[model samples]
Target chain A: AQSVSQHNHHVILSEAASLELGCNYSYGGTVNLFWYVQYPGQHLQLLLKYFSGDPLVKGIKGFEAEFIKSKFSFNLRKPSVQWSDTAEYFCAVNAYDYKLSFGAGTTVTVRA
Target chain B: DVKVTQSSRYLVKRTGEKVFLECVQDMDHENMFWYRQDPGLGLRLIYFSYDVKMKEKGDIPEGYSVSREKKERFSLILESASTNQTSMYLCASSSRTGPNSPLHFGNGTRLTVT
Candidate 1:
């Protein structure tokens, strides 16, 4: 079974601080990676996705993720984060089928 | 925009009661998924349907069953609700366009079993 692991459980940072959340998946075959974010009361929305070609994929709201096949990692990054970036971030992987395996998720709190 | 609509935003049920969480999609997507989200568990897939009348169990489908009579709707059912089943249930739909297609999610149904 394929599983996703997110190293950071919770992160607290001041506004304008850089953010990087580590994500690793346990799949060796062709995989699709995604970063989804959930606001306080909003549904989960796609922040970015990596299907093929480019390893560095840019997403909405200044979010980006790099898919490193060698490392089996697709980490989410942002040069600077705002208070609005405070949300729960999830890393998901699809290896064989339409089913997506998600990591435990990282709670990000950006303070102003 | 693709829309996945869950019927309820909040639900409270007693133990041993049968509970149903409804989800409908407007994008004519061929795939619909049911997931339960906890504080640290992220989203665990409970069940998924690829087409009408075709359902498959996901990683954690022990206490749940699903119904997909129509292509646009998928339903998750808890035969006997328990306290452990209390969590935020999310419904998502995605087209079978390709592997890169992201899921469109409903706002979610927060269920509490007493």
Candidate 2:
């Protein structure tokens, strides 16, 4: 089974700081990459996804991810983050099948 | 927007008791999934159903089973609950758009087995 790896376990930053979370996957075959976010007391929601065409995908809340096939990475980044963007971020990848493998999530704590 | 609802927010059960986690999706999605989420372990798929009465075991299907008798509802059953099985159970659904389609998740059910 394929696995995903998120290097950062926890991140803490002040408001207006730029945020970047690293994500890497194991499988080399055709894959779909995604980033999902879960706010406190809320369910997981899609942040962004990458299937084909463009390697740079823009998602909600001014979040974006770049899928670099050679590096086997799809990293999530934001120019400036708000306290509201504080949430648990997950990086997921699925191979030809419908089963998605998720990384150990990263908890982003933004201070006011 | 897609809405998925889990029947229970929290549950506690004994070791030898049978446990059921129910999930219902309002969207007419063809696929439904059951997953367990733990800190640092991420989300692990337990089971998924493609259509009515069709089920498939996922990466961690041990000690767990699922049923999909209807299109909207999917049920996960544990024959004898164990302490290790205690975790946040998540239910998600997606249309048959493709494998790339994002899954719509429901508020999870936190289960504890004593």
Candidate 3:
């Protein structure tokens, strides 16, 4: 079974602070990875996804994630965050079979 | 733009009542999924369909049944709603025939079983 792990449960940061959310999955074979975000009252939207090639992938809203195969990690990062970036982020992985497994999610609170 | 819509944004049902959650996608996607979102559990897949009339069980399929009679619509059913089953139900669709496609999601239906 494939499972995703997100280490950060909650994070609070001031505006313009750098942000990094850790994500790791337990799949040995080739798989697709995705980062999804949900604002307070909105639905989950795809921020970015990794299909094949290119370890580093850029996503919407100034977010990016790097897929490191060796460590089974695909960590999301942003140089600076805004108060509007406050949302719950989820890390998900899909195997060749198309079933997606998601992490527990990290709630980020950006202070002005 | 792809659009997936759930029938209801909020629903309240009593215990032992039958509940139906409808999901529709406009993109003619081949794959549709049903998931439940809980605070600490992330997103748990309840069921999925690869093609019309073909359904598969996901990680958490217990207490849930699905119907996909048409390509554009998928329905999730709770034979008998329970308080523990109260959670945010999410509907998603993907174009993948196998498994490696990005999914588009609906706004979700928040179900409360009292």
lDDT of 2 by residue, A7-81 (tens): 999999999999999999999699999999999999999999999998999999999999999999999999999
User: Which residue pairs of candidate 3 clash?
Assistant: A98-B99
Chain B TM-score, candidates in order: 0.99, 0.99, 0.97
Ranking by DockQ: 2, 1, 3
lDDT of 3 by residue, A4-60 (tens): 999999999999999999999998998889999999998899999998888999999
**How accurate locally is residue A30 in candidate 2, as Cα lDDT from 0 to 100?**
92
Off by over 4 Å in 3: none
Which whole-number lDDT from 0 to 100 does residue A70 have in model 1? 98
Q: Model 3's DockQ?
A: 0.78
- Candidates, ranked, lDDT: 2, 1, 3
Local error of candidate 1 at B47, Å?
0.4
Give each model a TM-score: 0.98, 0.99, 0.98
TM-score of 2: 0.99
- List where candidate 1 sits over 4 angstroms from the true fold: none
The alpha-carbon RMSD values of the candidates against the true structure, listed in the order shown, are 0.7, 0.7, 1.0
